[model samples]
Target chain A: MPGVENCLQEAMAIPGAIGASIVDYTTGFPVATTGAAPNEDHEAAAAGTADVVQAAQSRSLFVSAVPHDLLEDLIITTAGGYHLLRLVRTDFDSRLVLYVWLDRLRGNLAVARRRMQTLADELTTR
Target chain B: MPPAVAPSRLLKQAADDGRTGALLVGGAPGGTVYLVRGAVTYAESAAAPGVGELLTVSGRLAARTWEAALEAGAGRGAVGHLLYEQGHLTQGELELCVLGATYDAAYFALGRPDAPAEFRDDVRHWLGDVVRIDPGALTRESRRRTKLVEDIFPQPGLDTAPVIPVTRAPRERVSMTAAQWELLVHADGQRTPADLAQLLGRAGYATVLELRRMAALGLIEAPPPATPDNPDFVRLPRAHGEAVNRVRPAVPAASEAPTVPIVPSGASPPAPAPAAVAVVPAQVTVASAPEAPARPPKLARRKPGARLPKEIAAEPPEPHPGADEVLLKRIRTALRALR
Candidate 1:
């Protein structure tokens, strides 16, 4: 069974991955993080990402039908990088989101998305 | 009153005594710090933000937490012990809460020297006992929060101004945490985020830091530092226009006060003082003024033949009251005449 640290390591090993973090959405706290980002405060960053995800959910028209289900994934492609947020639903109304920052030039978006989905399934089952 | 011991001194004493409890209260000259047996509980400081404000403003915990904590049984393990038993917070969250409480207490204690401080020896906070903090952990968290504020705002001058939103391009959308949203909503045109946090029951430093971050993201604007010459920059009390009017004395009117005349005996007394009279004029003014000229002339010019015929007015009402009801009514009428 894949643990939080193993999941993060797998995400970082993905082609062109720069930084990755597993965050608890309910508390906006970072469970773990792996990255080389300079002077980045992980707690605040995790909180900020959770805020963004929440805002998207609020604004999305699809929110009403799926009341208790987790958000599958979010992808934002910038000029130089790709930011992916994958939500993993767990017991006790808890959820963990994996945020992977990928280099746009070297990353294959389709493959990365598939890999994150599989990883999310593994993490949730464990 | 006792000589104020440095926080370091208190920490060392607690460590040496192998105790995890101490209560700090008040500000400056008369502030009190009590070293307790189990855990620190029921701390208050004039300068530090209150726990009630912190929890409420964070939107994480409800205000009921304060009442629950305060009302818990008193004595050695009263408040803190009860909070732990209730399982309202994880051990780590509890520790964080206490650390935050200590900082706020210290801030108030050191900031204002004239305030008196009180410490109860055996009293405890119900929720506070569930968690423990190393002095080092508390200091580290405090430093981290301080650094966060500096990193976001860069300048400390904007720390106390009312947070103002700045307009930017639509493409430059900025995101804010829930706490940040609460801070903004509470920050009318007055009260710096720090002040708002204190007023709203949130962590002052965290609120300030988040406010700064919002400002950096161009989501908010920081006004110029307040000064004697720039009094407008000072946060004004949030007074509603109606409230201001209510408190202000009404301007004296130029019209003369009407006089009251006494009536001769057997005659009804002159109308009571105008002041005592219901000021019905004002109430009717709007309705009467507009219709006066239009309605009176129209009523006078109406022809008598225009009135409805008597037969139309006397049309019989639908249905009948039954015979039993008529007899009951006649009996009641006869009884009334007899009385």
Candidate 2:
């Protein structure tokens, strides 16, 4: 029963988490954000995350041949951090994405990914 | 750079003073921006769909449920909390929906360049403060979205004009976003982006942006020209490399002349004169031609206010067929006051 702000707060609690945000990929609007972000701008980080997500979702080549297959999470690892995006599924057209930026040194990528999946589900489920 | 004296300066001033209330922006498609102790909590525009419209239209909540929640909590400005507590929708769904709706409306509400804004102290939105946006951040996002739309398609005229799909596709293969596909299916050559937004319960700015993208891809009709003769004419996008000159030249003249009856004779003289109509043959020629010089006579004949009448009446008699009349009437009254 976590709300948007609560879910964002939970994401910030992840090990070595630098920033977290809920983004609507359709319009690239950040629903809520917490902690540090790239270039110190959460808005830009959210917009960039949306562009990446949209690129992955729209391209025919990126889509699997399996019917009804959906993209779950996207991970982009840089030298200093890991950018993880987990799609939030809903009954209607799904548009929300949970984005987390974790310090590569202190954050366990596997733990962070698993926790984010749970957070996304908790945020959506009543 | 932004102007030193924009209407949004009112928002900046309120934010600086840490005031809790609503700011009413007055003009065409005007809206109110709700702030809580200086942070923007919500915004709604006559041009975009509101949170209630989004929820009910998306089937996330029943119309009856939304009405019941509003009846119970609107006066206290706690509809968001009430719905969540009542188990009508999840907390996350309500927050995300409000945030999305607020940003969408803010694009039209706070982004206005010339609209005058007034702040009333101690007002609050029915949904309460589910999300708080920095005034500066909201303004920056609005500017970025505006620039993005221009970059996607420079034709601002197409935003309000009717979304008319081309008679045929210009390319053998075409691709479109799901939103664009929805727009194409709903477009009836009469519903402008704003009208379609209300009808489909989608954000107005998003609809405009998608229609502009479709125009750039040659998927929809080019916007009606600014000429007085064809004031309401919606030109279908022509097939690429088609016979540009050989098709029925009088077809445009015939269609353009009779569709609208509001055009004054002196203003739209091109309607009667076949010679004037010939210059605007195939909108693409006017589109593909080197920008300004190709249609010199047509451009020069245009009067400043000749198109006003048509634009004012462009919307259908009933803009929101599915929405409750009382709510819409209140909005209409507010919009009329601002206008």
Candidate 3:
């Protein structure tokens, strides 16, 4: 099973993946990191990401009669790269998220998504 | 080099060099305490009610009292002493208030020379006797208390504003510790965690810190940051709006299928699980479906004598269950299991 460090290594190994970090979304603080740190403050980024994920879930379009579960993943595509945030629900007090920066040209969106899900599961179990 | 007479000495010498007046002191026990200057300006304490807050929230004095006190000729004495003498506070209460205020004021005062001191000599002249605080001592004390509070509950933002719950909580729920529960109960919408500590007769910094810790753990909402430009506006609604949007979309199609179906195997019904899953599909389906059918009944019913109970009448005709209510239910259920 992958630990937090190995999880980051695995994410970095993804083609076009530049850096990765595990963040505690609830407090907006970084839990672990790899690659050159993102230009944004880690805490602010985590908090802002959580806020974005939350906002997307509650839009009038999404809030129908059904009760939804927690957020699973959020992806933001920019001109340069893709930012992928995956929420990992664990028994720990703070919720964790895997933040990965992927180069737009080198990344395979489909494979990255699958690998992230698997890595999140492994990290949480370990 | 005389072994660099420590940071404390340097701070004290700096204060003296600047000629900042007065002193305020505080601490937990025997060690060196914290101190602040005499003007008693810009004080905050996790141990006692802040002076202005104490005056405002205690119901003994009004804003006008502070204004009047501020304007009152030298007869009124210091605001801190007047509070004590007028049966508004006890000696103990006064001490705590002074301690908190002085420390807060001193915190801002230290290492800054150009900034105008909050309290002037005119104000002090009216205050009668100097509060007689040892500025250096109180500074040390405040620092120690702050550290203790942070150690217990690491998040900040507890001391600056009124305590307000971000979500409507259940009437009964369990907290991880008794102190956490006390912090919650004391969290009135108007008081910061530090103020709440004073009002509830608990340690100020400790309460603020613990409250923030609870907030981080999703037990409570952090008090919104203080913004002078729009003091009355609440930030929680915005935060709630954001939180509401972040959840995954619970599509109706997903809920239509039985959450945990017991399919028969080999021509025999599979043994029922020990406990049936509490299916929330009905709720999900209702929430996700279009509102076309729900709005008309209310529009039609309003035409005639509509004499439903007030509570039911108050509800929106369509009665869309709020996400917060659903989340609260889930939290309560989860907490119950922990108990």
TM-score computed on alpha carbons, candidate 3: 0.33
The CA lDDT at B197 in model 2 is 88
TM-score per candidate? 0.40, 0.74, 0.33
Model 2 chain B weakest lDDT span, ten residues long: B232-241
What is the TM-score of model 1 when looking only at chain B? 0.44
Residue B306, candidate 1: Cα error in Å is 77
By summed lDDT, which 10 consecutive residues of candidate 3 chain B come out lowest?
Answer: B24-33
Cα lDDT tens digits, model 1, B8-83, are: 4454456456554443433221122333453333344432454444443454444455344544533233544454
* Segments in model 2 whose C-alpha atoms lie over 4 Å from true places: A91-94, B1-5, B227-339
In terms of lDDT, model 1 sits at 0.52
How high is the CA lDDT of each candidate model?
0.52, 0.75, 0.48
- Count of backbone collisions in candidate 1: 14
* Candidate 1 segments whose C-alpha is farther than 4 A from its true place: A1-126, B1-69, B74-77, B84-128, B167-179, B198-202, B226-339
